[model samples]
Target: MGFTGMEAQKDEDLVTDLTGIHHVGSYARIDNLINFENNSASQLLLVGQRRITIDDVHDSDNGPLRVSISAIETPLFDKKNQMIKAYSNEIVAALREIVKMNPLFKEHMQYYSQRIDIHNPYILADFAASVTTGDGEELQSVLEELDCESRLKKALELLTKEMELSRVQQSIKEQVEEKQRILEFIAVSKLLGKVQGRIICLVGPPGVGKTSIGKSIARSLNREFYRFSVGGLSDVAEIKGHRRTYIGAMPGKVIQCLKTTQSSNPLILIDEIDKLGRGYQGDPASALLELLDPSQNTSFVDHYLDVPVDLSRVLFVCTANVTDTIPGPLLDRMELIRLSGYDGPEKVAIANQYLVPKALEKSGLKEGSEHVPPTLSLTEGSIEDLVKRYCREAGVRNLEQHIEKIFRKVALEVVENLANTSHEDQHNFTISPDKLHKYVGQPRFTSYVYLERMYDKLQPGVVMGLAWTAMGGSSLYIETTTVQTKGGKGSLVTTGQMGSVMEESTKIAHTFARHKLEQVLEPDNAFFEADLHLHVPEGATPKDGPSAGCTMVTALLSLALDK
Candidate 1:
């Protein structure tokens, strides 16, 4: 029965027939293939143009017969060639999985493509090595291939041997610049006489380089810069951090400076130190003592950090318009440098070295123009006139502003002229003093008044006196004239906002004048019995101090001597 079933199944095998036709070019027979019921023996067969398979043959089955069977066409190509498309799809899937597992491979692939395009084998090797071992040896190997092995090795050797050399060079350069900057500060401080710090107190009439020199110092030192105007700073906490007990406790100016500079050793400028206010809370100047003192600043403690931070390395610089307002202890710790008013010669140099070039650039003058020469090509005579007449300040701050104004006017003319001419032929304009008035308008000062004021105004009972103040020394005229007598008894009248000391000096002068007159002209006569009056000019100015002592005496003597 099994043999019969197998034969029936083989007869219905269409796939077997087609496969047999492709493989052998003939049909196959099922009875010769296998016995299905016995289930042990199996066989394959070809009958004509068909194929067949069978299983389980037995002797009772009446010879071999087909049972279960299956068949398919034999492809004309080999199995390897037939599965090529499926194999390629599997390969693609595997590559995508690898990319997902390591994203760096994708980046490496892109880099490799670029490297191959450029024929940079070194870069390719380095990239590959970086991906694999993550070491720089591959990069070094690439360098060797590029013929840079010796140079790189030498550079690395030098770098190791002289690591501190570069640091020393930088330090030396910083020191040189610091010296130069301090010198400038010293000059200004000397002019002002006494100031707040070694960095120099640039105190003069406004517009001087008082603030600028500080900025210049920071630039010269290559340091991070910050400016806090203590013009009205009343709280000491503004400089020294508040205690940690307080909410929102923050670091003071010094700590903030340290954070900003990143380096402990930065040139810090405290501007307007003299302007710090004395308040009920505390004095900022007292707080500055810890920050500025070189001896005690090694372990400076901030309230916020509550840790001892080293601030000895930092260079503290301070500037002020007035030194008298600074605390005595704080002032004593500083090496005061004073900046005075710029003289004519100095102004000329500043103009030539700094201001002129700046002005020309600002005026839109071509960088390499030969025709449009420096406007400040003014002679020494003219520059001197400008200094004395136009820009008469203790410092060149106003002078800089005036120069800027001059350039602004020149810029308009330059623009207009360039607009009218071809670019190639636009280098024919020059600015002279004659054209100066046209651009800068009329001269702001008269040369005549400055020249005339230089000489002393000599008159009866008037003597020239030199007086020293924060503004420097100036020649003062002490004038004394007889006024109408009031009573027979000698009395003294004083003016010119005389201080108590100055008023006392006037009384002394009267006594001295009376004694001299009595001895020289009227022996045994009473000059003290007559009324006398003494005064100083500029009555609105409140003048005080003992420096006027000799002036008052000399004026009284001159009056009594009738010289």
Candidate 2:
């Protein structure tokens, strides 16, 4: 009768406990609540019916749970405490079962049991302090085995070392990739198109990547890049070097470059070869010819070195704005690659590919709050407009600067806009052609008038005469007029800054006209007495050449016959 009554009382207590408790839906919710409060000292009302005081909760010695209060409203505190203890014990028993079944937990438990100093009273005290009273024996055993402070310190130290090593490795990887990119850029095609002994001349306007290309090649080949400017170099000794007998003997430019690069097979860029000064000192171009020639360069003897150093393996590249100024012999040996001015399309391509991304980075907008849309790509049309109207230089150096300007302006505007907007409302931005004008100043050129003029005046007498001058090939017009005269003085009056060659051409044209007129017209009536004036427009432009002979003759004939 006593056992039956005790079992009924236990059943009634369990039923009351279950009925009053507000069940948590999931273990995840339970964990979240625990972390939310840090399991710190706080007060929680059990189902809003009973108030429970929670102390500083930590890892338990016996089990996961610590205190469980009664669900009743200030009803039966003594009975509640006993019920809580019983429930806590039940939780501890469940944990032990879990540990026994799980291989990982069992192994950890075994390791802890063997390593723990159960005999030390101080160790036992620390273990007891760390664990809660109602926790299971399995938790207590695990807690006793752990040296929390020491383990934490060791883990932190190892993580710090690993982080540092990772940073170093990343830095090294970046450096290697950068080096490889540089090498690839330089190792494109060898200048002369032949690997053997040959001189390659880089002919282009200023700032057209000539010098940069030379350097890139040297870096790519893992060789040295040497630059020597022969622009005003008048002395042959600058190239061949002064003899040892001379008081101030020094090595030539070639030897000096080799010494600087510390390699014989380095790329040597001889700049401004066309502008080599010719004076009383000696012809530097002529000396350069000896160094550049494949047949003669093998035993290139420098007077300072006093040794015939083999320059056959060395790559020689020459840069010049004009090839005509170079010595004939040297020019003959070199294979010239003409790097003409960048056209509108090429400029746009280069700007979009290399300039814009770099400019964006320079503007400090990489990770700013206002995200610049990557989809905001530079269109071919926009680039064409910019190149044609705004940037008209042969090289894109100025264009690059203008692009940077645009980026800077846009970045400022973006920053300002972002500052005005709320953080939640901010979005990615784009810069379109309509907005481009606000950033960059007005266009440099209104229109290309030269091309328009060329196409407009395409007639019989107004022929497009291409003349080669010191500047370059220029188009000029040859005009002619004939006046009937009674006097017998058959003479040609040449105007528009005519030179000796042009004057001679006029005489030739006059004679040809007279003979042709005599053959075509009646010989009795002398048409040769007429004074003829051959004039070229753009009188400010001094013109002199043998090439204008055919044009002059054609013009005079057209005027005489009125054709």
Candidate 3:
């Protein structure tokens, strides 16, 4: 028979299962009744007793029968050891996965696993129960659990959740650190005031590499590039986005540029600032002051976003044909870099190095195989003649176009020759100085086209003068004529769409002529008796500046004295 007992000083402290020791209710079965075997003289115990005294179990005959327990407890230490080992191993495995998920816990993994191994289920349960959320609620619901297995399962569940949370926290930390570093970089850049505060304005004529320079700067800095034209942008909403209340509301060009490049520090090219227009809507030039200003762009607020965006790190590059039309306030914020047009030698060099190869490739005339000989070539003299005779503007855009045109014609000729002649008899094509006109049609300019003709048909009232424009310098012919009037008093008149500056120059020339030539001219001469009409050729072109004063005086004096 199995027997179990525990000693307690008070009956109130006793708690045990009495199902095996109790007799079956309402039945007297030999196995169900506890057979004392007459060992105890007193048998006063009854079934289902709620309370009992120690004296009730005392034997009167044998004086507390010698109850020597053969074996008090049969310890299944192996099973208990197995259970403890299994629980500790599972806990270690979970903790190891935790370390793998987040390496920040790796350093303490061994120490934590050892502590868990020493205390086993008890310590493991405590660890899980201690894992409370920010609001002080337990992470796992294992409270009041007396079974070790149940507690271990709850602890594992809690560990898995905590590990996931640790990974999430780690990711968030890294992102925050990266954002912090970027902010610090921006702050340092702003403080240094090198490229951050600077806004560059590329001032030059058309096709002078202003936009190309902006692209090169972006490439060199390894920053994203974006370009937009403000040439005729009149609405302020184009710079700063439209409000959401509008039908087709959107962010301004600055915001759009940032979005298009997907970078906060992209190189933005605001093209044709000088051509920015002002209409009834609003002034875009005035709006650009905030976008291009370093001191205020840090907190640039868009009407659509209605939130300040930090644009201190963005590099702004603006282009303009000239600065004269740009608003003063907007112009004051930019640093001007002048890009002059290419000269003759410069054009020739550019054509040889860049334009020729590009044109050849585009026309499918360049040899594809490196071992193959070049099929098309241009002599330096021919290119020099092309530059002097045609494409005489300051920029190489027209030069490049002319080269491409030549390559196209050469390509056609080469194809024709190849179709007719045998491969062995084929020869390289070259355009010498003499053959330039055959392909390019005819020379647009000549060295003595104007001056030679002027000298050949020299007249008393006509003279040659030089004038400078954005396209480069050119010669102009000033002509003067006298129209006899009924009265001797005379008036001076000028034509040729001259600007105020040129008109003033004409007046100055007239005054100088009257003072110096009053004695030289006779009283009855047209200088005193007729209206002097001064005219410059190319009447459609609007000419300005006082540089032509001397030429005007020379023409007027020649007409008055018929010199």
Off by more than 4 A, model 3: 1-198, 245-248, 367-375, 421-428, 448-453, 456-461, 481-488, 499-501, 519-527, 545-547, 558-563
Which candidate do you rate higher for lDDT, 2 or 3?
3
Whole-model lDDT, candidate 1? 0.58
- lDDT by residue (1-563, candidate 3, tens digit) is 22223233223333233322221111112323344666664344322211121212323453423222221121233336676567667776767666676776676555455645336465565454444231122331343344667666666666766665565444334435332433343356647754554577878778767787677556544579999999888899988899999999999988988888889889899999999999998999888988888889989999999999999888888898888899999898887777677777888888888889889789876668332236457999998988888877777888888999988887777666667656625666767988888889888877623233446686999998888876656788999998765574578889999999999999999999887788776666556767889998889999998789999989988887788
Q: Could you give me the TM-score of model 1 versus the true structure?
A: 0.57
Q: Report the C-alpha lDDT of model 2 over 443-526, residue by residue, as the tens digit.
A: 666664323243454444444466664332446777766555567566777789989988898888778867787776675554
TM-score list, all predictions? 0.57, 0.51, 0.60
Between prediction 1 and prediction 2, the one with superior TM-score is: 1
lDDT of each: 0.58, 0.60, 0.70
Question: Taking the tens digit of each residue's C-alpha lDDT, what string does model 1 give over 163-258?
Answer: 232333333334354445565554464475433233334454455565665666555444567666778898888887899899988998888988
Write down the worst ten-residue block by lDDT for model 2: 24-33
Alpha-carbon runs more than 4 Å astray in model 1: 1-227, 242-249, 366-380, 416-457, 485-488, 524-530
RMSD to the native, candidate 3?
A: 27.2
- Stretches off by above 4 angstroms in model 2 are 1-197, 204-222, 235-237, 240-251, 278-283, 295-308, 337-344, 355-382, 385-446, 454-461, 469-472, 482-490, 513-530
Which of candidates 1 and 2 reaches a greater lDDT?
2
Model 2: pairs clashing at backbone N, Cα or C within 3 Å: 61-140, 62-135, 62-136, 63-135, 63-136, 186-216
Q: Which candidate comes out best when scored by TM-score?
A: 3
